[model samples]
Target: MKELSLYLMSLLYITAGVNHFVMPKVYLRIMPPYVPFHKTMVFLSGIAEVLLGVGLLFTLTREWAAWGIILLLIVIFPANVEQLKNKKARGKLPLWVVILRLPLQLVLIWWAWLYT
Candidate 1:
């Protein structure tokens, strides 16, 4: 179960990272208007996610990778909040899923902390 969770988490990050480069326009569109340098932010975030994802796959840097992921999660949280707010306004992304993700972040952080 633990291994499965780790694999899924790693895969999720890698997929998201790839998307940041391959489909950056989508990500850019979602960025809150107040943020500056949207394109640059997307590119940098992509690189970070890819590195973190690759690191998580190897035992040598798993702890550091987990820590990185936790930090990344914290850093991107405001965007998540903004996404949820937008979705709420649009009546998209069902309320239950949005609510569920709020606590899931904590769980993911705890999981990362444990790995570290």
Candidate 2:
């Protein structure tokens, strides 16, 4: 069960990371206004997610990758918050979905911690 979950988590991050690139404008929209270099941050975060997701596949890097994921989730949290606060960022996404994302971030962080 643990191994299966690990794989799923890796895939989720990998897909999400790829989405950042495939849909750069989507990510750019949610970036907190205060954060500088919006485009650079979006790409760098995508790279980090892909690297960390791959890292989780190996025993030697799993722990570090898990930690990195936790940190990454924390670092990107403001974007989620921005989405909730700024209607334009949320686009046509439902109010409930945007509101739910804040708590979902905590759940994601906790899930990553399990691997650590």
Candidate 3:
């Protein structure tokens, strides 16, 4: 179970990281207004995600990578809040979906903690 979870988490982060570059505009839209250099931040975060995800694949780095992912999730949470707040303005994504996402973040955090 531990190994399976690690693999899934790694895949999750890697896929998300790839998406940041493949669909940068989607991430850009969800970023809070106060944030600066949206494009650069998006790209850097993508890199971080990929690197951390790769790190997870190694036994030696798995703990550190898990912690990195947890920190990354916390750091980016405000964007999720901002996205939820402006879901209507951003697009027609359902209110329930946004509402559910908040809890999902906590679940992701807990899942990351397991590796620590």
Candidate 4:
């Protein structure tokens, strides 16, 4: 089950990372205005996500990868909060979906911490 979770997590992040490049505009919408260079940040984060996801595949870097993922989750949290608080930032997402996403971040953090 642990291995399965890790595999799924890796795939989740990799797919998300790819989506960052494939659909950059989708992410740009949710970015907090205070953050500068939304496009660059999106691209860089995509690389980070892909690297961290790939790193998880190796025993030597699994813990580090997990830590990196946790850190990424923490770093992006403010944006999540912004998205929930500013309905316009969330675009078409229903209020309930935005609300539910806040707690989901915690779940993702916990899931990543399991590797650490």
Candidate 5:
């Protein structure tokens, strides 16, 4: 189950990385206006995600990958917060669902830590 979770996470990161490159424009739009060099950040983030995915593929680097993902999740949290705030203002996503997702990050981090 641990291996399965790691593989699934790796697959998800790889796919998300590919999407960053393939559909950068879409990603760019979501980036916070305060972020500078949007395209470069997107590209770099994509590369980092790909590398993290690769890191997860080996047991030797499993812990590193877990830490990396946790850090990444933390780094992106502000964006999620902003999105949730905006959604609330606009009455977009159901408040319950958005609030629910906030705790899910912790679960994902815990899951990553478990296999490390």
Candidate 6:
């Protein structure tokens, strides 16, 4: 089950990373105004997610990958918060739902920490 979960988590991140390229507009919408080079950040984050997800597959890199994932989550958090600030980005989602989503990042961070 642990291995299965690891694979599932990897798949989740890998799919999400691929989505960065596939539907970048969705990501671009939530970017904080102060964050420079929005496209670059999105592209690099996609790369990081892909690499870290792949890294999780190996014993040698799993823990480091997990830590990297934790860091990545932290780094991207502002974009998540941007939803609260930018209602247009919120895109009809309820304010409560957007607020609730903030904790989801911590949950993801915790999930990554499990592998570490």
TM per candidate comes to 0.80, 0.98, 0.94, 0.95, 0.80, 0.94
lDDT of each: 0.81, 0.95, 0.90, 0.91, 0.77, 0.92
lDDT of 3 by residue, 4-80 (tens): 88899999999999999999988998889898999999999999999999999998998999899999999999888
Q: Which candidate wins on TM-score?
A: 2
Candidate 2 lDDT tens digits, 12-96: 9998899889999999999998999999999999999999998999999999999999999999999999999999999999999
lDDT of 1 by residue, 1-116 (tens): 88888888888888899999998876676577688998999898988998898889899999999999999989877666666677633244676776677778898898878778
lDDT of 5 at 112: 69
Look at candidate 1 and tell me the lDDT of residue 31.
72
Q: Listing every candidate in turn, what is its Cα RMSD in Å to the true structure after a full C-alpha superposition?
A: 2.5, 0.6, 1.2, 0.9, 2.8, 1.1
* Candidate 2 backbone collisions, by pair: none
Candidate 6 lDDT trough over 10 residues, lowest sum: 8-17
Model 6: per-residue Cα lDDT over 1-116, one tens digit each? 88998998899888889899998988899999999999988989998999999999999999999999999999999998998889999987899999998999998899889999
Give the C-alpha lDDT of model 2.
Answer: 0.95
Once fitted onto the true fold, the runs of candidate 2 whose alpha carbons sit more than 4 angstroms away are: none
User: Candidate 6: misplaced stretches above 4 Å?
Assistant: none
Model 4 per-residue lDDT tens digits across residues 29-74:
8899999999999999999999999888899999999999999999
Q: Candidate 1: deviation at residue 103, Å?
A: 2.5
Q: Which candidate is the best by lDDT?
A: 2
Query: Cα lDDT for residue 86, model 4?
Result: 82
Report lDDT (Cα) of residue 99, candidate 2. Answer: 93
Model 1: pairs clashing at backbone N, Cα or C within 3 Å: none
